[model samples]
Target: MGKRDREILKNICIESVAAEGNALAHVNGKTLFVPLCVPGDIVNVQVTHKKKNYMEGYMLELVTPSPMRLAPFCSHFGDCGGCRWQPIPYDKQLEFKQQQVVDQLTRIGKLDLPVIAPIMASENTVRYRNKLEFTFSNSRWVPFEALRQEAGAREVPPSPAPKAGHQSAPESAPLPVSGSAPATQLPALGFHVRGRFDKVLDIETCHLQEEPSNAIRLAVRDYAIDKGLSFFDLRQQTGFLRTLMIRITLTGEVMVVVVFAHDNPEAGEDDAARKALLDYLQHTFPQITSLHYIINTKRNDSLGDQEVIHYAGKPYIVETMEDLEFRIGPKSFYQ
Candidate 1:
């Protein structure tokens, strides 16, 4: 390849859809894989790798959008990172998904197999099912757009202090302050940032779950903040509220599990902390059939080994499907 051809490609026209939900385009006879793009879209990409048969690059700029592309329905698409293929039409996405299965079976498996059935696409795309987990972080994941707006000038965090509008912690609420240092970082109750586990993006409205899902999550977060409930700090592994798990069954029964760090008062913990949050939730959303809480002192937040205590209602929620009745625990797997 010539020197010009080897340079970073600009306004490269996408040729076709490629494997692994990537777009394929030939650059100087080498196939380049560009993610978060569809065919007919022209984009400027910075080449990161050069392989023998294929190359890789990240999308730098979108020059011309593909006609097949549709507007993303989710507001957190760019930063949240779960729904990368939202811009692509659902039918096109389904086509690629089906092709992916065939490609894997024929190319990778190398086995003689009969024609597979067509991929089944869900009729309802938004909030089709139940169950979602949102994490709490002391520091919210800052989006690149914020930095871009700053234009190389970053905003300095103010000296650590209680967030504005939060005056005093309830008698039962956990310690509101992280430490003596100025309370600069605010709390975030949302999904983890893409590729960065320590950071989480504060979600405003998630379309993953049905009606009360968003309502319940927002209410809990707001109530906790207003009552000066301490948000769990992953680094120090202190604070009060940690992860939130919500499950809704086919019978419309909802189960919520609120995980706290501990109940030791010396560590700024409180036994009533769980009760305060649960009482608020129960009063606000009376539809909750089963409400529970857990105390996880370890550095990790996995609840498999932790003991789940029932705060208000039944310990296990029952779900019936045909002839089988499955009782779900606080941390049970559901399809």
Candidate 2:
């Protein structure tokens, strides 16, 4: 469609949270869904997709922020696919989720139900998840906002050369010098960007999992980069570090599983590099009750059929509930 023909909505108040966490509003008789907004928000949106029953749009401007909206905790909130619904308060999130369940049961299932009680709320909003899996990619995603900010930032003078007697400090990753190119082509160890399988966001910190998780991931990334290990390219399907998985139990046991890619048949496995990385983690994080690694030769990330090798500590971590104890392996399924 032409630019002039495109529909632009103005000052529409969001009514509710719809399925899949999109902000809902009613335009005439049809439903409108806008992303990155909450109920009571007034926004101007440009419709991207239209249908007989509903419409989808991207927010042109948040004309007025919603009172129900809270400050999102994660820096990668909008771009990261790991989470959504961060703006809504936890209580309000529960309310919307509860309503979603009721709607699904009554409308879709066509079932008669008794009065539904308020959905149970989590005591802790952040760092409550038991598991998190991260991907290693050579192509790191640099946010447009960051590039723009760097472009406008004032320039600083470069440091002078050190004296002959003194050793220079270690070289860190490169930064976008002219705001045109991204920081060093260093590999990123984090979650993938929304809708982009090849782009991975370099996460500095994550609020979903507790301490030692972030530290461990960062340490491994830095170590791998320092050791000159290759990061996996999603499109090319080659690299040494492919994925990392972390699992924590209520009993304070931690499990970490690293996946290495051996896509090249001729190069064979880098056993020395793999052993060194695992050894570093073992010495660095003594609290890791379970540590494992997997050799994933496949193009995909599925580890179901792949073998999980035990490196240190126990083969599995224990999660206890009442008098029963459950062992969670590298491939075990848990809520």
Candidate 3:
């Protein structure tokens, strides 16, 4: 009925970090899953979802940081959407990963499972990934904290707000929190946020992909913004750039696929913008041995049924397996 009577859970201590990177807690005997936090982290969670057996929420405020929590290595830690377990210790990550597997096999199954071995740590944490696909979005997601702040400010005497999905606000809107700035209407070039297919987080300095990945991504975004290139909008399903797919082999060969939303060469300056983007890529990234482009007007940014065009490089890169050579095209699924 009023702001003071609102049932926002405050000072909720996270009990344990789940396998899927969500911190698990219980409120009134119902499971509550929270993101961007670790076990022992005391936070005020704003419930975004409520169901019979469980609830989902975003961390409203960090009342206290977990003692096991370490400083996130990546600058885009919480915002960019991936690497949610960054605050947790490495050992904990491995433990949870193993436990997740054992969970489905042992706890949730009927089989008598064997003793599960510890997860072997990867020698490389950052810059270890060989392939990564990035999406281009015209709008960016507004975090829950800001959304809640905006909702509070816009409260019309608290007449029972409808579902969050019902409100017709663009993904990026003017929602300012006490400490953070308002979300922008600028375009985004990054990985899709988990469960939010229409939203992209605009990744900066992704630690997953190795060198030249982050560089190329940032370069593409900057050049596109500077050149007035159009980013693909999921809602309207229009624009020039759709998605970027980059694949690198250990043998030093790299393949890049530039997916355009639609191909309109005869249209005014569309061809020029396409050519300019390609020229910049060719001139900038000399290390790209295999470069290609695709014209995909499909509703989704998926590579399904799309024709790949080899623009300025080999049709396929060669990968040797002992005595045989394997051909890897721009659309290859080796990885």
Name the top TM-score candidate: 2
Ten-residue region with minimum lDDT total, candidate 2: 171-180
Question: Each model's TM-score, in the order given?
Answer: 0.80, 0.86, 0.81
Model 1 / residue 302 / CA error / Å: 2.4
Provide the RMSD of all predictions against the true structure, rounded to 1 decimal: 10.4, 10.0, 6.3
Worst 10 residues of 3 by lDDT: 172-181
Cα lDDT, all candidates? 0.75, 0.82, 0.75
Off by over 4 Å in 2: 1-6, 152-183, 263-269
User: For residues 1-335, could you state the per-residue lDDT of candidate 3 as single tens digits?
Assistant: 34333246778989877756788999998999988888899877667677899888777567788899898898666665578888888888888778777878877786798777788898777776667899998776655544455774553222345344333223332111222123446788898766667878778778886668888899999999898788998989988899998877666777788889887667757767877888888899998888888889888766768889888878777776678777888766764
Clashing residue pairs in all predictions, respectively, total 4, 0, 0
Give the winner by lDDT. Answer: 2
Candidate 1, residues 32-134, lDDT tens digits: the string is 9977778888877766678898888767567788999787798777567577778888887888888777778888998677877877888888786668889
Arrange candidates, best TM-score first: 2, 3, 1
Candidate 3: residue 334 Cα off by (Å): 3.6
Candidate 2, 142-179: lDDT as tens digits: 76555545555633344435344422222321121211
lDDT of 2: 0.82
